[model samples]
Target: MQSDICTIKVRDCSYIDIEANMAIVINNCFISTNVFRVSPSVASDEQPLLSYSHTHKKWLTGRYIGKLYFEYNGKPHCFEVQPRFGNANILILLEEIFNIKLAHNTSEYKLYDNSDNELLKKIISIIWVKTLSKINIHGLPKHKVEKLNKSSTVRGKIAIKRSVLPIYKEKYVVSKRIEKEVDSTIVAILKKAYIILCKDYSLTESMLSDAVKEVIRVPCYNKKVITTNQFQKIKYGAIYANYKEIVDFSWHIIQHKKQSSMHEMADTMGDALFLDMAEIWEKYLFTILKKCFAPRGWHVYSQQYRIYQNIGFERSIIPDIILEKDGHVVVLDAKYKRMTGHFSDYDRTDFFQLHTYGSYMESHNKKLIGLGLIYPLSERFDKEKLDKNFAKNLYGDSTSNTWFKVDGICLKDSHHQLTEQKDDFLRRVESLLLI
Candidate 1:
């Protein structure tokens, strides 16, 4: 029965039950343990997905969002990790970052329920869009298929029975014809994926109409469930390369199964797909900043390696974002954490890290213009009550002759369009870097 499945949903970096068996499952492979004791050091191999603090008697979650299903103590348990901002925001961020279309009005969808399947389907659909968009005029994958034919001359293997036919056959020869035909394996998998996402998962049909038309163009492409062995046996080459990610996501859908079959308790452990919020946050900031600054000849780079030699070895420092234009350089670190504009609210380590980056840039170049920390404005900061200047100039002492500043970017958009937030953020960043 579906009732037998126990699901525990938690936000990233939140606490989980101490009795829980913790594991980090990604793409189907997993590492799990029943109990994790707090130790001074954790070996790379011995690290558990959920770290336990023996002193606190709780397990701490990591930055991940997905479903993990396993049997512990003869009971089926599903661990679902969601983003701190909720499912809708993650979908919005993915749409913006990947430049793919997703369902609008995400709040109207079945997102509030405990089921992780909705989010999973949305992710699969996004992958489908991405893969399909890359297709050129060459269209779907095709392979050489051999067909027996009767022709005037020999082409492949001659058909003995057809050649020996009594009627008019002396002038005709039966041979095999090798023709390039659309690959049935790939079409079948994609069709099944579409049905699972649109029909079963209740994804809006219009959202995938273009993709549907693409699949429908394949003549007589039958939608059928593909077994694991069948999928594994399919060969991949350059022609079918773009379909790889969509197929993998479809396979994930097959493993999860429908709610009606929850009682079966199949050996399929289901799928796990997670995005690190910290990394996504960094990338999101980089993308927006680049869009706003790149038009004016500002070069924006992310995770750039700056290698320097220690006394005995080589070391490198990778700062999140670096903006340079005409030899004027600005070093900034994107912090996903909330900011309240208080000096004590800032982390000492983060301050030191940014300071180190600024010092390094200044030492290497004479024209380091600004050093700053860009953080997300807390949800509690009502956008309506705040002016544009509130987004920046949070706390700084430029009069002290150090162009170091703390800035906040509003992450929430009341209209859900993000136009205002993005515009404000761009203006704030430009002011900081131009100074």
Candidate 2:
């Protein structure tokens, strides 16, 4: 790894001298871990995003993976978090989430490198593709734009101030024409970004498809130089949410390119691009279960919140996944932890947490039929052993009772390729979560 770039896995730790590296500190003591919460958002008690051990001279990572950039002493530094299971699984996760294929290169795994630029670029391209696809569906958003044109005949409205000028006495009349056009700062930036990405980052028409590229065929540059500030403030309807996302990615691409150009920009603190792996796992499970259970009229919800109040105080508890079909309700928490199918390998905290969640649901919903935990099935773990251990954990519970269970999703095949056993995994999950 490069001296300037340090890489670690999610939920792992790294050695970074906090006293030596002052740039990581957004404030006096606290280091900013999230991109959005650059200033004031501190970690909640339940989710300790990041921490440092001064005595150990190490920075402990939370459940986040991506690249964070920091600058100190006129030098740029990067703190990267990767998945413990390696690049393939992370790629699969991204592909599934984005609903796009990110072609994998074998060279990436042969030797680890400092720059995660390739992965970052793939993500940017995928975002671009998604945005372009939406644009194709919604058509380019039209905006009312005013243009000043000089004509012999009067136009929409004569510019009184300009028409009265001495230079325009017997010449052409200056008029402002307000016309609706498929052009804006957002479109301009994305157009420029498309060119930059394709020319410099190997983003191809083949990757984005000819149809997607046709959406931005005509360059929308209105000769306006879009700054980072303008890019950040690009506005769009809440209905077309991808517009803002595309603009954000474009800005990142532009800034990254500028920063790579011989360090022309000043050393400054910037936001990091990261994804919560555990959240991704939860979302993946929710999406899969929703698809699998949709025909049966089951509704799947992610991060459903419930209030628990005692005496005068109230607390909120959120479960990862909840399913409702007819009058039956099932709550499940997706865990991205390492499991070895051993009886003692389970965490007691998870059991207690699920117990609280189940108890709340049982009391409130009366139709609550099940509660469960789901873990990823890796090549390192045995599914039969996991089932046996899970059954053993349920010691005195009746076999017929479907109140609680533990299950696994086969996320990888034996060869560690993309998952081909999703049907099997979904079947197991259905059997465990539903009676």
Candidate 3:
């Protein structure tokens, strides 16, 4: 299944009101004004919730991805969105996110190359093409074993289901199910993918048409049995080797089930689609930190919980990234936000959070702990100043060589190229921690 992002205008930005029925999910970056948060006339309990406010019209800015259902100027609307991250394009960010997340390159990697077109349609086309190519190379005949018909040579022992085997002794009851069954989980995924792609509008992929035609002939139904473990093995089939990411991405789209309807497909066309880019950045950075640190004999743990404070209610806190090697520990909180050119309350709050984490980890574990803010480098900041933005700051302990430090992770270097960004970031991080 491909994802579609909806574009909309709040039409009446000056004034608006809301009721309890309609809902919307906007990234924290997006404005909380009444125009930005709209509500629908119909009462749909399943809509994503949002707070309403009346404010002036302005450009929409938010990298958080999620679905929204609302009404503007008397008409209802539905959208699946991936909003831009600052001046950066959303699709490119998606490419970076997924590449880092999957950490594997498939033959269909080129599917993400074209950014000027519809992402969902192109992805659907690529999936169809890649799947058909694999099917052609390996042939569609799955090794389906049968117990009756006496049409093919026996591949299994004469196994029967009921006690009436005596009468049908001549018929070898092949109870063994091998890989060739059309109803196998892989084929079920394919059928489901086909239906999902079919529901998309304005598909230009010619192969998609052929794929849909042949999909109807597949002797299987969309059983909705695709599981996490089942998905991991689907790509290992002889033909799917190069098609791994495409199929895996398709699985991602399929997972977004409608809360209201079990049988309904993901809202790719107009109604439903979205992803949390904020959560994604935090998660992906954690993954990168894990991989980069592991090779250096550092152990990384994500969402490590500790008792920051304990009232009668027994509340706890979780840090996004925690790394330990020998007797040294690094506590980090990932922020998927751009720098404000100078420090603000946000930075102060973040520093306080990290300080709290360092104290908690050090006191209990009795190890030298350092705190860091991991943030993406954007075009708005002076790299030199931003790099040393923590120099005069309260966070940093050169005396003990462990305290608060600013990561200033450059997503792109002076050359403005992203290709070398990952390695450069890791090296910088290593230097920052090992120092």
Q: Report the number of the highest-TM-score candidate.
A: 2
Off by over 4 Å in 2: 1-61, 67-80, 105-118, 141-208, 215-272, 306-312, 343-345, 380-383, 389-400, 413-418, 433-435
User: What is the descending TM-score order?
Assistant: 2, 1, 3
Error of 3 at 273 (Å): 3.2
Taking the tens digit of each residue's C-alpha lDDT, what string does model 3 give over 1-435? 233423342311112233223323332212211111111111111222233433323232333344444443444444334433321333334444344221123443333422222443444344354445444344343444454433234444444553246336654334333444543665666566566655541234444445445644667644657777877655355554544544554554455322312423223223333334455566557767876788888888765353525656655567777888887788778776545454531457777877787777777774755667877665433457546654422344345646556654555423245535656666756765763
TM-score per candidate, chains pooled: 0.59, 0.62, 0.57
The per-candidate count of clashes, in order, stands at: 0, 0, 4
TM-score of 2: 0.62
> What value does the lDDT take at residue 308 in candidate 1?
60
Clashing pairs in 3: 34-53, 142-180, 143-180, 147-174
Tell me how far candidate 1 lies from the true structure as C-alpha RMSD in angstroms.
9.3
Query: In candidate 3, what residue range of length 10 has the lowest lDDT sum?
Result: 34-43
Minimal lDDT window, size 10, model 2: 35-44
Give lDDT per model, in order: 0.59, 0.59, 0.48
Pairs that collide, model 2: none
Error of 3 at 96 (Å): 3.6
